[model samples]
Target: MPKIEEAQPKYLQIAHHIRDQILRGDLRPGDEVPSERQLASSWKVSRPTAARSLEALSHQGLVEKRQGSGTYVRSLEVNRRARELYGRAKQTGKIYTPGEYAVITSAGWLEAPDYVAEALGLAVGARAVHRRRVTNNDSGPITLSTSWFGPEVGERAPKLRDPDRIREGTLMYVESVTGRQGSYAEDRMCARSSTDDEAADLDLAPGAAVLIVHHVVYDLQDRPLEFAEATYPPERWAFEQGYPIV
Candidate 1:
């Protein structure tokens, strides 16, 4: 075989080399890649050139650079892929990916905020079951989720008021109690800076941008069942949905 001529930029070439290592399992997620100085020494390149290579990978979201710490491969892509297959995972009552866990940090009746009330079609100041949860893996927090259920549904499903992982998950429990299936969901997506509480919960720096998804779920009768807001660190999660054209 003739030696392949490489035409890509030096930094890109280095990025590709490191990327291959990750793909081949040589450098697993959360594993640190060579430091810029190490790369510069090994590749006989300037430190800036090595830095560019790592920066390129970071931009691709394949790795993350921690302040005062070196770059480490990101678990985001793998986690996202697993989540993408959640429709299949749901059948087994296993909603999360391997090594991941979700906890209901708090659950109780709370006065609905304007936004939550509007989403769930409840009156302002109405009491609603509010459930707060955080999902995480060894890589740290993945998402912080808060769900509100209208009194009609909330009171019916007493389990929703408890602070624990719903063993059968919430949707199934809703179907069981209401004798109705979730017929549709409306989602609104936006990007916003982390709130102080959100920053602390997610281990993100203040003002770091996060992806927010607000969900309104309805039953077959077209009655709103729940309103939920899920906040994700941009690098750790991506949202995807598909539907057939009517």
Candidate 2:
């Protein structure tokens, strides 16, 4: 079927109407809605407009899009899963380096969050040194990162405490002291939203997006070593992960 007008299509209006019916239980789960031809005839609109309405419903989770098959009703859970999948596909993925630590030192305020405490296995209000630096290729700071460490660790390396030195990068000091004899480290990442402050620090536009990166360095013993987090803007930074072949 032809696409509706790009400039605020009328079919989208029809789509919303059908969507309201679905939400009101007038169209129950597993209940098929009218076919495109039927909808076109009933609405006195083009077949394309009818098709667009169905497509819109498909996008909103009221209908499922199946290849070579007509659309069908989908559950709320299916809609959620579809949204998650779409988000995943949009991600550029995490990019980390081996044998190289990007030293980040930017000032971040300490607001106690339970997860941060749990990650470091430290008590609440325990002082942490967080760094902010951008990890982009000559693109300036693409992702704003605030790598954190307990104050005690930074104290050991007087340089870690210094704003200038820490800004130069302090992972080296952590590696020399608490880290094991490994040249490489492990980094774990998960999707998270950005805060207004984070968006500002990263120099992102309001409502601009970022990828939160959590990097943990471990000794050969597999014990928890150091933990740091970086927030990446999709424009400047991308992550590459390599998994072992089975």
Candidate 3:
């Protein structure tokens, strides 16, 4: 069989490989990562590409470089429990995990932001249904999630416009109402300073570091059904998953 190729740049592939090791606990905190030359030799890539891989990890706050010392794993806080939470929600009609609850801060029809509009294939500044919520555990707020849908979805699923929690979970509720099952989802993530609104919702000081995930769920037709932005306060949440190597 022909070998399947990765679409990501070689540097990113290297970075992701290292990241997986970290998340899998194969590389614990303070453990030294392979040197750039070693990575180049192992991955059969240029030294520049290997160095870029480490740089990418540093930007994600996954590793740190020391003077005269090689890079080291800086954190092992990444957990796969977040995925479990969603999976349980889908199966049990519960939106949150044990010891977690959410407050619906706002829910109504509003003009979608340009990015959200684009994700939902709507014109710029088009009106959409917006639902904002903050999930909290005993430790305090963990995530601030804002979900957007086209106006038509809101009209069909009127409960989406209410502040009450959807006992069936939003995704399931949408599927029930619209007959549009979520076929797949895409996530784009970045680390950046929290906005004032996000900081307030997540109970962090303004300008604090945050991990933002832009998530879009698509129907069988590959049309986006919902666009959500989930913001996590620094040091509070991380995502980890393992997959088979080809």
Candidates, ranked, TM-score:
3, 1, 2
lDDT of 2 by residue, 1-246 (tens): 333444555677677556644543345567777889888987778998789889877865568866766666775321111112122223312122212124344554464355666676678877766655554333344445555666556566555545553321355456567544333355566655677887776667776666666666555776544566666664432323212244
For candidate 1, list the clashing residue pairs, or say none: none
Best by TM-score: 3
> What TM-score, over all chains together, does every model reach?
0.65, 0.47, 0.67
- Which should have the higher TM-score, number 2 or number 3? 3
Q: For candidate 2, what's the RMSD? A: 17.5
- List where candidate 3 sits over 4 angstroms from the true fold: 1-83, 244-246
**Distance from true location, Cα of 30 in model 3, Å:** 25
lDDT, residue 7, model 3: 60
- Report how far residue 121 has shifted in candidate 1, in Å: 0.9
**Full-model lDDT, candidate 1:** 0.75
lDDT of 1 by residue, 1-246 (tens): 112225656676787677655543356789999999998888777899899989988977789999998899987443232223224335456556456778788999999999999888888889999989888877788778898898988878888998977766676677789776877787788899999999989899998998888888788889888788888886644534222244
RMSD of 1: 11.6
Residue 240 in candidate 3 has what lDDT?
51
Q: Between 1 and 2, whose lDDT is larger?
A: 1
TM-score of 2: 0.47
* Candidate 3 local lDDT, 84-113, one digit each (tens): 445656655675555568899999999999
